[model samples]
Target: MTMPIILPRQEAPVAAIATPVGVGALAVLRISGEGVFDIAQKVFRKKNNPNFRFTASKGFRAHFGTVHDSEGLIDEVVALVFRSPNSFTMEDMVEFTCHGGPVVVQHILKVLLDEGCRLAEPGEFTRRAFLNGRIDLLQAEAIGEMIHARTESAFRTAVTQMQGTLSLRLDAMRELLLRSCALLELELDFSEEDVEFQSRTQLQEELAGLQEELHRLVDSYQHGRLLKEGVATVIAGLPNAGKSTLLNVLLGEERSIVSHMPGTTRDYIEECFLYEKTMFRLTDTAGLREGGEEVEHEGIRRSFKKISEADLLVYLLDISLESYLDEVPLIRDLLERNSNARMIVAANKIDLATGSEERLQKLRAATGCEVCALSAAKGEGLEALKRLMSTMVEGLDKLHEASVLVTSLRHYEALRNASDALANAQELITRQAETELIAFELRSALDYVGEITGKVVSEEIVNLIFEQFCIGK
Candidate 1:
C-alpha cells in the first residue's frame, strides 16, 4: 500500500482586528490556523463555565466569554468557533466580538499576540483562503473589487465574479482543451501505430470554436476596465468656455470654482458621478490656448495631457464668442492627436446665442462627431447630454445580461495568450506538422487557461494577486 503524501502547511497561526478602527458598537478580532483553539483557551474565559475547554467546543458554536490578559480582564466578548477543514482557510478559526473601543480592542489584540498569535499582514487571511483551496485567485480579486466598488454596476459585477461566473466559463474552456490535448497525447503515444484518437479536422473545428469564445472574452476587457475604473471623461476648451460650469452642473454641486474670468481654473478638477449605473470620472481641465503666463502654460500643458489620456472628450465651445471659429482649428488638431478617444462637441452658451441651430450644425459638420447644444449656466439640455454619456460606454446595457466578463487585465492577457496558442495549434494541424509540435502548442494553451483559474499558477503570481487585499479579509 502506498502512503498518502501530506503537503506541509505554509502559514503560521495569525490574528488581526477585522473591523475598522474607531468608535463603533462592536468590533471583531479574527484568529485562524492550527492550535487556534489553544490560543483562544489561554485568553478567553467562559462566562458561565470557568473550566470550559475551547478545543472541545463544537464547531460553529458561539460562546459568551471575557478576554483576559495575564494581569486581569481586558474586555467582555463573544467568541465564535470554527473547526479545521470546514472553516475559511480550512483551519481552526475564532472570532471575538468585543465592545468597540480603541483601548479595549488594542488590549485584546495584545493579549492574543502575547499568547503566540502573530499579527496578520495585509490580505493574509484571503491569501490563506486561496492557499488552502477555499477560493481561487479570481474570487480573491473579486473580493477586493467588491470592497472598493464605487457604483452599483461595479458592485454587481464584482459579486457575480465572486460567485465564480467567470471561473465556471474558464473551467469549461480548459476542460475542452484538456480533452483535446489528451487525444493529441494518445496519438503521440502511438506514433508508430499511426492511430488517430481524434481526427485533425474535428480538432481544428473545436479549437476554432474555443478561439472564438476566447476572442469575445478578450474583447470585453475595454468595457470591463471602463466599468471597473470609471470612464476618464475630460471637459476641455478655451478659457471661459463654461467647462467648470458644466462640471458643477453635472455633479449637482459646486465642486469646481466657476468664474467668468479667463484662466480661473489653472489646473484640472475631477469628480465621479453615476449615470445609468455607470460611473463617469469627469475632469474639468484648464483652458487650452496659446500665449499665457508660465503657470497658465503649465496648466495648459496638463490639460492637453488629460485630453490625450481621456477615454472621452467633452469639448465645450462658447457659442456666443465670435472667436469660437478660431478655436475650431485647435479642436481639429486635438481630435487628430487623440483619434482613439471618443468626442462629444458641446456648443455651450446656447442660451446667449440667437439662432444657434445653423452654428451647431456647422460645428457638427466641422468636427464630424456627436454634437450637443446646451446652456451650462442655465442647466438646459443636460438630460440629453447625460443620455449620450451613458450611451457612449459600449455594452453598458448588456452588463447585467452577460454572465461572464473579462474584467481583470491578467485574465484578459491570459485569454489572449491561450487564444494565440490554440490558433497556432490549429495552423499546425492544417499543415500536418509533427504531432510533438502540435501537442506542445496545445499544452501551452492549456497552461494559459489553467493560469486564469489558479489550477496551474506560480507562488509569486498568487502572492501578487492577494497583495491587493486588505488585512483580516
Candidate 2:
C-alpha cells in the first residue's frame, strides 16, 4: 500500500497572473488560499453596490466589481469566487478578470500583493492541484505538454494523457501487481505448510499478462517521445549540395541562406515544419568536405554531432557532381555510428542532372538505403520527400488513438524499471526461488509503478517535475 502524500501547510494566499502577460481584451489574475475572499474584499467592490460583501459570495459565483487602491479606482473588473475544497487548488480562490493592459494588470496584482497575497511561484497553482489530490503527476505533466504542443498530433496526445488514459492503464497494472504481491506474501507466511496461495502455473500466466502490458507501455515510449518532441532530422551532404535549399523548400520560405558558393553554410540552421500532422525539426547542417576554413571545420564538427543525434538523416547528394559516389563512405560511416537513425539518400539538383533515375539507383545500391530524386531549388519531388518522411513516422498517427501511451521520459524510465523487476519475479517463480525473494522483486515492481502515478514519490521528484511548468500554470 502507498502512503498518502503529506503536503506542507500553506500559511499565506498565493496570487499570480494566470493569463499570458501583455495587452489583450482581458487578463485573468488568480489568487488561492484560505481567507482569499477577505483579501479580495479589501480591493474589490461590486459596481453600484458599495456594501456588497465578497465573503458572502457563493463558490463559482462571478460578481461585476471595480478594484481600487488608496488613490482611486484602478480597473473595472469581474471577480470570480471559488470556495475551498472545490477550487482548482482546493482552497478559497478568487480570479479577477480585468482589461489586459500591462499597467492595469500590474496595478491589480500590486493591490493583491499589498493586501497580503504572495506572488505565486512557477507552476504553483498546478502544484497545489496535484498536492491537493486534484490530479496525478502524469496528468500534471500532460498539462505541460498540452501547453507546449506545437502540432495537432501533439495536442491530441497530450489531451488524451490529461484525460486519464495513461493513468487508468497504469492503475490497472498496479492493481494486478499488487494482487500478485499479496499472494506471494501469503505464500511466504504459510511456507511451513508447504501450501501455495498462487500456483506456479497461475503465477506464470498472471506474470505473462502483466509483462505484456508493461512491454506495450514501454514500446510506446519511442513513438510517444516523438510526438512530445518533434523528430530531429538532419539535412547533410557535400558543400553546395542544396541542403539549405531543401530546408527552404520544405519550410515553404527562405529560412536559410542559400548560395551557389561552396561552404556558404558554416553552421547548422534548424526549423520546424508539420508534415502529415507530425512535426519534423529539419536542420540544415554544414556541408561535409575536406580542409576548409577553421569555421567550416567547426561547422563540419557540429554536422557530425547532429547526424549522430538525428532520428532521421537526409543525406543529400548533388547529382550534377561527378564525385557523388565519393560520399558513399561518409554515409556508411554515419550509418555505422548512428545505427538507430533512419537514412534517406536524396539525389538533389535533379533538374540539372543527366539520367537522374540512374543516379538515384546507383546511390541506393551504394548506400543500401532508400534514395529519391529531387531538385530543391525548383521544388521538384519535394512532395515525395515529404511523403517518405511522413511514412517514417507513420505509426504515430495511430498513437493518438491509443487509450494510453507513455510520453514522459520519467514515466518511461519508471515503467522500464518496473518491467525489469517483473521479469525478475517471473524468473524467480519459474525457478521456485524463496518466497521472500519473489516478494522482494514484486515489491520493487510495485514501487516503480507507484512512482508513475505519484503514489510513492519523493518531494524532490515532485518538485523537479513541477519546476518545468511556467509560473501561474
Which candidate gets the maximum TM-score versus the true structure?
A: 2
After aligning candidate 2 to the native by TM-score, how far in Å is the CA of 298 from where it should be? 6.1
- In model 2, pairs of residues that clash are none
lDDT of each: 0.87, 0.88
The TM-score values for the models, in the order shown, are 0.88, 0.90
Q: Residue by residue across 239-351, what tens digits does model 2's lDDT show?
A: 99999999998999989998989999988899888886778989999999999989999999999999998988899989888888989999999998798788888998898
Tens-digit lDDT track for model 1 on 1-473?
Answer: 99985542646799999999899999999998878899999998998798899888889999997998888988899999987766777778999999999889999998998989999988888888888877888898899899989887678889999999888888899899899889889888899999889898888889899998898888777667777888889999989999999999999999999888989899899999888777899999999878989999999999999999888889998998766667778888888878868888898999998879988888877778799999999999999998887787654435424456777889989999999999899899999998889999999999999998899999888888877777888
Output the lDDT of residue 418, model 1. Answer: 94
| TM-score for candidate 2 | 0.90
Instruction: Tell me the spans in candidate 2 whose CA falls farther than 4 Å from its real position.
Output: 1-11, 189-195, 252-269, 289-302, 354-357, 364-368, 378-380, 395-401
Instruction: Extract clashing residue pairs from model 1.
Output: none
lDDT score for residue 212 of model 1: 87
